[model samples]
Target: MSFADHTIRVRVPGTSANCGPGFDAIGLACTVYNDLELTLKKEAGVKITISGEGAANIPCDGRNIVWRSVQYLLRKAGLLDQYPGAVIHMENNVPLSRGLGSSATAIVAGLKAANVLIGNRFNRRELLQFATDIEGHPDNVAPAIFGGFTVSTVTRGDVECFSFLPKFRMKLIVAVPDFPLSTRKARAVLPAQVPMADAVNNISRASMLVAALCKGNEKFLRNVFDDALHQPYRAKLIPGMYDVFAAARKAGALGANLSGAGPCLIAYALERRHCEEAVGEAMKAAFRQHDVEAKILIMDLDTRGAHIVK
Candidate 1:
């Protein structure tokens, strides 16, 4: 069997999941991106090159997450034997284990490349489900694939999701600490169950958070972020978590929360204030007061999601 050469490029955005009380259900896509270029050949081997964040820690061979995802999609589509060779070039700007959906980007990128090479056998919705299957959660994967703000749930092995553009103008100030906290460790610290009261609290708050965003009500947005579930337990591992959240709020942020798991806090600041840098510095100083150093990034909502380019 002979197949003509093909090249597919993909750009997937980084995501912040568990926004406030949404808890594995809601997510936001930011400007950070991980780019991949794949070229299919008639040969039967794979070559990958990765640079930028996670360059040292991420594998460049068969064990790489991107390659593994590519293989999974290709074999599932029954096209692996036909297109057995590929050259992959990746630029990973999202940091791993920092709660920035770096893994989500990789999975989405790989599946997209494989689907493109096979003549778009799977649509975006199917690809979103595939990415969510690989990630074990839809919050991050949904937004990484769909962009903007996404709320998703897993029901009977199916990923159901909806996404929308922000009704309000805002900027995100993400403060990343010097240390890394794996999602496994963060989840391990959480309890297997919560009280009924806590569950009810999160349910209401999560609903309001969505309404707040849709209605552009800053008051509800600010008040709706309180959670009684994961944040308190994970706080033990994240340095200056509460203090940093407070600092950002005092400096003109609408509200703040742990980006996804821990070690990075994303604050929603008003774009009109022009005080993002000051808020960032306050967050850094708060972490510094606790003997931890952190860096900051300012980004806007990425509404276009992931796409393929020539």
Candidate 2:
């Protein structure tokens, strides 16, 4: 088929990073996504079009994450000169800097689109590594690449990923406030040094959480989501953080924590009905208590990773 006859579209899942004590090592892909359409043109230049959230703020030129990802893959495969220029149209649904992995989704979508446009030259692992390099971390990129709930660790300059299909039915309730907190700013609030006791505490909790997930033991998870490394320090940045967690627990959620950075809290529930009601009530009470408008969503785990639609 001619390049003009093929249209590549990729949908990438948004991720919630640092689940409880996993801290930069675990992530789950949610139902939210960003869609990208790539059409090869007979012309000689690259063109980019964007719509939806962050359209006006995101870069539209070669500096865009999507553009950079595509360019990186094409160059790595040594087909940069042979491939025809293309037009990339992005439809973004995930909000930026709200603790959602919106940037990672855009990068993964672009890489998937480029790979399809070039006839699947790179495997999923290779594509993930490339995207992770661009993202500077693998928590979000791992789940966005492998889908479902993923436990990842970066060791010796490489990312190790393990995927788990949740045995128990679980729903994620996310509450995003109107105010945005940049991930960089949130990181700044964290302390550089931590006590040994705190370190051991998080290690045990992280291990327990992972074991509970593997065994599908909800009881073990009831108190296993505690974190001593990041959440305690970052909680200062989010107003009424304790109240949000308290509200979620009171509403029958298993556990709740700051989604990725701050301002967006995520709660885990076993039943859809309970989750829905809990999310609604938690959002209302959280907003009332914190004096900030918030939006709440009930999202499921995304099983399929980034892929081309056509």
Candidate 3:
């Protein structure tokens, strides 16, 4: 029953939660990913090797999020003593603490890879619940598990998610600012209660957003990516946030908003129109206007959420 001979590799997408109006409810899985390779060791120490984004700051010991997640799952299955150590390798393309769900990516990758190593005793839904429990929300983890665009809600302690992949092609233009805004700090600025009007606005727009994305209705999408819930409060954390959104829209983007919490902004554009570059540059230049240097990444929706590569 030893898993020392099994090497599991899993790829998890970087997720953008909130999706403008659907605060804490909707998420989109992008093409950018973090890949994890996990090999159980018969010995008793955890070892991690990381490359790409956040490698310099990421921990390589038991403190590492990837290793912690693996340990969590293994402990749940009562296999921690039998497989007390692992060699974990992570190649991360997702930025850290920049609203790109980097932690969710790590957690999903670890859980998925660990499950594969243990004979996949956990199903995707079970994995989603485990990830949600660890993440404190299902927005990012749902899409990381199910892929595509996900609308999730937690009821009584269970996670229910509906995932959709639109037939039409769309490009995602993300402008990553130079600074990082932690989710805790971003959320701290929010008011405990919002005006009923703002709440109604978010409800309407979030519903419209889900419907439009599900139907691939481009006309409806143009106005639905606006938020009245978290974005306005979180905007102060990211300089020129609204200006970046305006620049993207003025450059023929359908819409744009904060990717998850703050700092990184994502814009949507039709693939057929070839306006992605213009939108990306517009967002980047807007950040430059505020003396913030930003990097732009052009990506598409990831349909396959997290999967074993080997």
Q: Which candidate is the best by lDDT?
A: 3
Question: TM-score, each model?
Answer: 0.97, 0.94, 0.98
Candidate 3 versus the native: TM-score?
A: 0.98
Q: lDDT of each structure?
A: 0.88, 0.83, 0.92
Q: Compared with the true structure, what per-residue lDDT tens digits does model 1 show for residues 1-310?
A: 3334777889999999998899999999999999999887668888888889988898888788888888788888887877777899999899889999998999999998888878888998899888888889898989998899999988899989999877877899999998999999999999988999999999999999898889887777777777889999999998789999899999988888998987689988878888889889999999999999999999999998889765
Which portions of model 2 show Cα errors greater than 4 Å?
A: 1-5, 41-44
Q: Is candidate 2 or candidate 3 better by TM-score?
A: 3
Q: Tens digits of per-residue lDDT for model 3 on 1-310? A: 6788578889999999998999999999999999999998778998789999999999898789888889889988899888889999999999999999999999999999999999999999999999998889999999999999999999998999999998689999999999988888988999999999999999999999888777888899888888888988887788899999999999999999899886899999999999999999999999999999999999999999999785
Instruction: List ranges where model 1 is wrong by over 4 Å.
Output: 1-4
How displaced is residue 78 in candidate 3, in Å? 1.7
lDDT of 2 by residue, 81-183 (tens): 6564778899988888899898889888878888888788898878778887889888898888889988877777777789887778788888888888988
Name the lDDT of candidate 2: 0.83
Highest TM-score scorer: 3
TM-score of 1: 0.97
Ranked candidates (TM-score, high to low):
3, 1, 2
Of the two candidates 1 and 3, the one with more favorable TM-score, higher being better, is 3
Pick the winner on lDDT between candidates 2 and 3.
3
